[model samples]
Target: MSASTTLWTDRPLLGFDTETTGTNVAADRIVTVALVHSVGPGRENETVATWLIDPEMDIPEPAQRVHGISTEHARAHGMKAAEALDEVAEMIADALRQDIPLVAFNISFDLAILENELTRLGLPTLTQRLGHDIAPVLDGLVLDRGVDRYRKGKRTLTDVLAHYGLEQDGRLHTADVDVSATLDVLRALTAKFPTLGTSSLEDLHREQMGWHRRWAEGMNEWLTKKGKTPDVNTVWPL
Candidate 1:
């Protein structure tokens, strides 16, 4: 690759995250979402778009506690689910069409949830808009696990931000906050591991697929040994 060609680290990155009614991708509704666009190494180079949606369903107390968005708040202040879903999905597709890598903590969950929302609303899923599979995603969590296999601690967004000596940008679990924080963590990850910053997005995307599967298979083995259900999704970007 030519040095003049922008790497994923330096080129435009679209950071994504969602606050949902629950963890059930197929069944839950997307209550909020953030798509952060970064064209440089700093937050000053970023433009963020966020949305709160009335999911047209109850937001359970547990989910409410995590994202602080109650069904009542959504009903009163949020946009209609279908309208917000259409706008959000198109923006994401537009970004991807321009070859911007979507950066997120655990991208599969957010990407899957967004796709499901679009499908549930009878709108075009991102894949349908892009005319191909989603590609060139940069998942900070998957890459972090691959590079530091022996680190013993939680890999939550909070844990990762601290682990990388990156100060907390803001409160997490909120859609916009988590999205920007994930981008910061990825910047730190690439700085610490130079190869990650230098590799082409296509190569990095392919490597992450293998990385996520290996992590999942190993986690499944450990869970099996403990006689517990293996709950990790082994797929990349769903």
Candidate 2:
């Protein structure tokens, strides 16, 4: 679809997510990754790709409890981290080149971890592949907070899904399932805020960067008030 004639929802969206060994984007490894490409507003066309990766490190118990993939299982059944990461990066780069939004919940974590993994593996990062920083990303978490700023309580993927009156069939924390849920949540958000649906993907992406920056600044301020060090990054796609 032409950008001038199509709304964000009318165009294709590539949903992405990762089940990692831990929450440290700088050091953690990806245990699993998923990418779902949805076309048309009704989602009549979709292509889903997923990979289980041997992170080459022990999967801590707490992390395993969240995603339910043990180190033994991954080592036995997963692809090499370098190979899997290369494929994931290439897929994402292809999507961005096609002007498709990469939909993810709390995308900063995924992108950050992926970049770190690529760098560690001596592979070209997304920026290098795309010739610039990744853009035109649609973050479900950022959009939810931007449009519904006053809403209280948690804003995790599950929380946002419930807030939008949607449900996931499979358990969360799985890469594929989480990607599907994230796409659904984005659709729900668009339904609730029709204006968002009407904007161009690039516009929506730029808007999200602003939204995320504002949110991070506010969080840092709150943390400072509580006498805690503010560690949040105000940058987008970090």
Best by lDDT: 2
Task: Give lDDT per model, in order.
Answer: 0.89, 0.90
The local lDDT score (0 to 100) that residue 17 gets in candidate 1 is 90
Give the Cα error of residue 193 in candidate 2, in Å: 0.7
Cα deviation at 226, candidate 2, in Å, is: 0.5
Candidate 1 lDDT, tens digit per residue, 52-161?
99999999999999999999999999999899989988888888888888889988988898888888889999899998889879898999998888899999999999
Worst 10 residues of 1 by lDDT: 1-10
lDDT of 2 by residue, 52-160 (tens): 9999999999999999999999999999999999999999999899888899999999999999999999999999999987988999999999999989999988888
TM-score of each: 0.95, 0.96
Stretch of 10 with least lDDT, candidate 2: 39-48
